[model samples]
Target: MVNKLPLSGETVIFTSTKKSEEPYELVRQLGGNPVSYPLIRTEERVSVNDDERMMQTRNYDWLIFTSQSAVAAFHHKLKRFKMDVQDYELRVAAVGEKTAHALERIGFRVDFIPDVFSADVFVRQFNPEGESLRALFIKGNLAGTLISTELSLSVDEWTVYETLPEVSSAARIVELVKDTTSVTVLFASPSAVTVFTEHVAPKIGWAGYTIGAIGHITKRALHRMGAPVHVMPETYTLPELVQTLAGSKGRN
Candidate 1:
């Protein structure tokens, strides 16, 4: 006899960007009804000195990426200027495995990935000797300054993408949250949590559903807004999140 899927007959909601197909597919494979209700969208940010900034990447010893979106936006800038990734001899540091994979896809060798995927752990564990290092942080506009502030090295930040709330999905999100049955809502970023709090929480309130955050920062964000986090994986990756949720189904 075949074993039943872990998430059989459950509904899983994805609240990040619509481009997140991996986790969505994982949930589907686990026999959950996956829904793509993106609560945040990202757009590449352009500046008058973008060309010059792209050229200046060679000055840094390391390129730090915290998210796949940052890596994608950086790659886009490189292609726009007809620049090759090999032209810069900068080493790479990524906060998560997915971010490192994104860097590798663009021909970058990731030199560092902290044991934990959060920025606070990254800062604590990275460069423990307090060695002077020059790094450029490729991030979205909404990213916090924890890395720049806490790291012992000189860090320059490049805003390659801007995350905006996906207001259009509010109606759909309202409908989903209204149903309390076997529904698990997953949040990958604090920004997504903020969007949900501002737009959806007032309408439906944080009841009749299971909430999951991708990392401690996002979990903290949910707590700040008076929402309980039902599931959070030890490793802050999309695949891990989905797997953890699937495993939790048995416990619930």
Candidate 2:
């Protein structure tokens, strides 16, 4: 007699900018058939003044990172410019643990992380001093202005990457979601949620499937589109989302 895995026989769908291996492997480990139906793609932005922008970080007191992609793009620019992060006298604040880990991997010492991993929560909790600190926020093009608007600091934003919808994947998404009885679709970003609602939901009509969102923003996006969100973890991370789904046995 073998014990049944938590996500046994469930078809888990990942709809994000990129298909990450960690969460896919986790879903597979729990006996789910994981599918990568990316609804969005990210591209790093390049500029002629990349060197000047990279050098500008030295003047900021804090380097704020909201996503792992931003960290990756930042690191890539640093490497291209042959600049070492350690040489800059800047404190770093990450919106979540994953972003912090990504920064740490690239030799940055993360000084702050919000209790909750959302931009609104981050704005409320970060920089208690209100001492007119200057921060450079490295982010994707579609990121919200909440952080820049709410933070009582001299905040400047640099668009390192842009998130674009993978409109070509619409047919594949519809095909994979055809059998919805054992399917669990997970969305990571609001941008992906927007893409799905616009392109895929029109075909499938937003029913007969289990839906999971990574953060409040994504959940809100799904709700605004009249899609029912079945599962949302307390923590806004992929591992937590997978664990939450597994613990629930992939059910509503």
Candidate 3:
């Protein structure tokens, strides 16, 4: 028999620019009304107008991918730049499991994966030694500085993808919250939190709402925007955040 989740009747909003399916389904399985609103728009950076220098060579020691979006954007660039995925002879290091999975989907093998998903932790344990250990990271405009300064290897990061505010989804988010009472909004990244403020404008009407942040940076953004964090989970995973919020609601 299937178990019932405790979050029945609760409405939780998710912010993911890439139209995530798994996380949203997980939320629905838990009996929560999960709504996804993409906050950032992404596009491939490689183009006819792109710098010839940037597209010149794919030789690198390691290819680091931080998010699944980076993976998607990188592959798109590969198609446009006429890059041979096999031409780049380098090890793969991914910060998150999802990112690694995305690469795997494209038949790429990742050699270095850490237990923790955070960029800071990945840098600490990364052992990018050897002559072919120099690294190149395919990342977004809002990537953290950890990539450019890999503690173990010579690292360089290129903004292969850029993120912009998704105004339409943002506006729809505001509309959802306007009708729903006491909604719990989940911010997955700093960009999501940053865009939320502008997209929603006067806020998500936290008058009867709660906020949930996926990470520390997102927490800071919500507080900066005057949203009270009713629940900040110990972990940043989607399941953990949902469980934490549901548990907190029951406790109160």
Candidate 4:
């Protein structure tokens, strides 16, 4: 007996910064057709102040990375400045598994990852006392302010990238979602959710479609934008979200 895949004959629309091959391939592996249209784009920003601060990396006690983009941007900046990351004597803190993996890929020894995979969770769990414990936060310009504001350590933040809305043609997005009874829209970030809501929500009504949020932040953004979310995995990862959506076929 040939067992059918959970997401067989379904179409999933991915709205994020870029069309990643891994997620698309994963969706195909799960027997689903993946349509990728980035509604947000990430532009790496050169922070002169941060570049100067990078020279003094040894002074910081901890280096925090919230997203994979941040890790990539920070590493790119380091290479551009002719800095050797391996020489920096700093403990690294990554927000989630993906972010940690990104750091690990670049030869960084991640010292901490919170139980929960959110900035709020990371900040609350990483309770650093005193201003003497200086931590550098490498993040995007659109990042939430909660982590830096909440962390007890003296924080030095560097905006290494900016996320801007990259709305595609309404016709293109509409065509991608055409005639799909259960088009699962995947949102990985708050910016992606915001852009989708602003551009695509009006054309596609809430009926006959399912929204899948990758994490708490994305889910909260959907709620704030008045978009319905049908699938949100306990684990904030692409694989888990895809699995949750596969299992959420019959559920409202």
Candidate 5:
């Protein structure tokens, strides 16, 4: 027999620029209302410097992808620059399963995925040796220097995309979230957390809301911003995050 869904009458607010199907569908399956309040918007970075940096990817030994958006933006740039994916003899390293899957969907094989889905863990486990291990990180504008700072390898980065706060104003975001009685705010990255804390937290505190994070890194971001985390999945995936939140105490 099929099991009954727990989030039958609950509401979940997800913060992401692009539309994601898994979490939204899961909320509907569990009979919960899914609200997409995208607080972060990502766009490609176009410049002569960006183009020149992208052309230099072939010289790097490893290409590091931090997010799915980076993978998509990178592929889009590749076609625009007329660079064949196969022409770059570089191994791929992804920070999380979703990033790896995004690369796989585009026919790129990910050679390395850290045990933990965090940049700190990824860099520690990278184990770069010798001077020949040149690394290139394709990341967004809001990415921290932690990965490049921690990695022992000679690393260069290209800002393939930039993340902007999308709510327009704090008053607008506060108005959107004020009516959510049984609210659960889902965060996918540190950037989203930053955007929320800077834009929304001041207007409406986390008084009657629960916070859900995709991974420990995001959970830490919530903690750093003084937001309480009510649910965090063991695995950093949208499906797992939704399932965990559905099973949270008092959420039903």
Candidate 6:
């Protein structure tokens, strides 16, 4: 039906392997097009070596989780330590509602959750006024500087997850961009946008496509790569992105 394929002529690529049908449906409703092209691939960077050490202590003042993946990976590592949920006594703080929800499902009480779900916001909420609190940050290896700069607290970071490039997908994307007359690439993260543009720059050359970023950070990444980001949402969320595209249906 015409209603289901509102995005019939438009071909947009999603960055994650995970499928977000809401955006596709929204694009279809607006007579645009949508496609899936995962840029970054996720893999657990956890190991038994780190788990063996973490299990020996309960001195951390807080356990901070940045992403849902970090929470999941951290829990997965805990399973190898042969420990129950009672092993951790520290206060828990999470970056986003979704991350907090993941921790809550595992029966850990989250003590602090910031209003906004950005690195800068999370940093601002952390206390510099308190005594030196030993905080443990569970995040990706390539995390932003907020954790170190904001807290001024004694902190340790572990790379529970690593975001690597999908080399094959990147090539396919380049081919897709080169073959198509026009395309619109949706970028949700600065990292994804950076890697995407860097690899496709020489080949695609932006002849028939425009870049779309989720927010200012991602938009900035696009700029650093010398790629112009045309569509940016006022608020950052998957649903917001869908609505933004739905409002402007004429893009090819």
Top-lDDT structure, candidate number: 2
What TM-score does each of the candidates earn?
A: 0.95, 0.95, 0.85, 0.92, 0.91, 0.81
The C-alpha local distance difference test score for the whole of candidate 2 amounts to 0.89
lDDT of each: 0.88, 0.89, 0.74, 0.81, 0.82, 0.73
Cα distance off (Å), candidate 5, residue 152? 2.4
Residue 79 alpha-carbon offset, candidate 2, angstroms: 1.0
How do the residues 1-252 of candidate 4 rate in per-residue lDDT, one tens digit apiece?
A: 333466788898877755347777877887899887778878788755766767776689999998898888888877888877678787999998989999998889999999878998898899755557988888899888887899888888878888888866445677767766657888889887777777777887655677899888888888888878889999988878888887775343
* Clash-forming residue pairs, model 5: none
lDDT of 3 by residue, 1-252 (tens): 223675677888887663446666766776788877778778766656554634643667678888888888777766766776777666788876678888998768999887667787787888766764667877888888876875667777778777877877877878888888657788778787778777685655555677888766677878888777777767566767787887776665
Q: In candidate 1, which residue pairs get closer than 3 Å at backbone N, Cα or C atoms, i.e. clash?
A: none
**Candidate 6 similarity to native, TM-score:** 0.81
lDDT of 1 by residue, 1-252 (tens): 343588888898888886657887888898988888888999999999999999888898888899999999999998999999888886889999988998899999999999999999999987833367788999999999998888888999999999998988877888876764788889999999988999989998897888888999999999999999988999998779888888888665
Clashing pairs in 2: none
**Per-residue lDDT of candidate 2, residues 1-252 (tens digit):** 334588888898888755358988988898988888888988899999999999998899899999999999999999999999779897999999999999999999999999999999999998646477899999999999998899888899999998988998888879877955688899999899889988999999889788999989999999999999988999999879988888777343
Candidate RMSDs in order: 1.8, 1.9, 3.0, 2.2, 2.3, 3.5
Better candidate by TM-score, 1 or 6: 1
lDDT of 6 by residue, 1-252 (tens): 224443456677777555336777666666666778788777888565876656743678888897777877778776766676687887898877667888998878999887666778778776734687788888886788778657778888767889888756788888877777657788877767756766766677755776677767777887887778777767666556666654454333
Error of 1 at 234 (Å): 0.8
Clashes of each: 0, 0, 0, 0, 0, 6
Model 5: weakest 10-residue lDDT segment is 167-176
Q: Quote model 4's TM-score.
A: 0.92
